[model samples]
Target: MALKAPSFLADAMLGSVARKLRIFGFDTLYIAHAHDDEILKMGIDQGRAILTADKELFKRVVKAGARGVLVSGAGDLEDLVHILSKSGVTSVDLGGIGSRCSVCNGLLEEKNQEQLKNGVPGKVAEQHREFYQCMDCGKVYWEGGHLRRIRALAESVDAKLGRAVAT
Candidate 1:
C-alpha cells in the first residue's frame, strides 16, 4: 500500500523539528507551550500524528489513539528528516515548492507587480518579476536564491534515501 503524507502536531519541545518539517512542506503544527495532555488531545481531534521528544508523552499519546515519534538526539535536523523519510512519513511534493508560507503555514497566492509596487523595496520590485503573497500573514515571496538552496537540500535528502522525488 502507498503511504499517506501524515500531518503533524509537534509537541512544545520539538520546535526545531517542526520547523524543518514545515520547510519540507509538511503541515506541521508547532505548539510551543502546550501541555502534554493538550497536545495529545489536539492530535486526536485533528487526526494529526504527534512528533515529540518526550518519551512519556509519546506513550500517553499512543494510548490515546494518536501516533507519535520520540526523538532521541538534539540538534539533528538532518537525522530527523532522514528518519521521517525512512519511516514513510514524509512525501516530497517538489512541484508545489514555495506554495506554502515558511513562517506562518499559510497558502501563498500569486500577486502582480502593480499590487506590490508600493510595499516592496524599490530594488526588489524592479529586479523580480514574480511575487506571491501569504494569505494569512501578508508576507511576500519571490523565487529568490533561497528557493534554490532549499531545493538542493531536498534533492540531497531524496538522493540519500534512494527514492525518486514525488510528483
Candidate 2:
C-alpha cells in the first residue's frame, strides 16, 4: 500500500501557511481562534502533525508524543520550504495543485462548466473550461492567472529544495 501524505494542523500564527499547504494538496486545518489545547487535541485525534511558530507549544507537542514542527523562518517561502523539508517532501508536485480547498482544507471535485450556472461569473466561464468546487465550502476554483503564480512558486520551491538536498 502507498503511504499517505502527512496532514497538518497549523497554529493560529501559521494561518497563511495552512492555506498554502492546502493549495499544495496537503490536508491542512487552520483554526484561527483555537486555543493551544484545542490545537493539540485536534492534531492528535486527526493524526495531523502540528505546525507552529510558538517555541513553547512545539516543546509541549513533543513532550506529549505528538508530531510537531517549529517553523520560524523570516519569509513565507522560507517557512514553506522548512515545513515541506521537515515533512520529507523534496519537491512540489504541480499535479497536486488545486487538489484541495485553500480556504477550507476540503477536497476539490472537478466540475463541468455547465454544472455551474450562476456559481461562476459569465466572464470567468468564457475564459476557463475546467473548474473545481470545494466539497466542504462550495468555493469555486479555476485555472486563472493565480494558477500561473502557483506554478511559478512551486517551481521556486522545487529549486530551493534541490539546492538544499544537493549540499
- Which regions of candidate 1 fall more than 4 Å away from where they truly are? 1-4, 73-80, 86-91, 163-167
Q: What lDDT tens digits, residue by residue, belong to model 1 across residues 1-167?
A: 15566778877777766765666777778898878989888888988878877889988977876777777656544655555764575445666567777777777788989987666888888888989888898989887888887777666666655552353
Clash tally for model 2: 0
- How does each model score on TM-score? 0.81, 0.94
lDDT of model number 2? 0.88
Candidate 2: residue pairs that collide: none
lDDT of each: 0.73, 0.88
Winning model by lDDT: 2
Model 1, C-alpha of 45: deviation from truth (Å): 0.7
| Candidate 2 local Cα displacement, residue 22, angstroms | 0.4
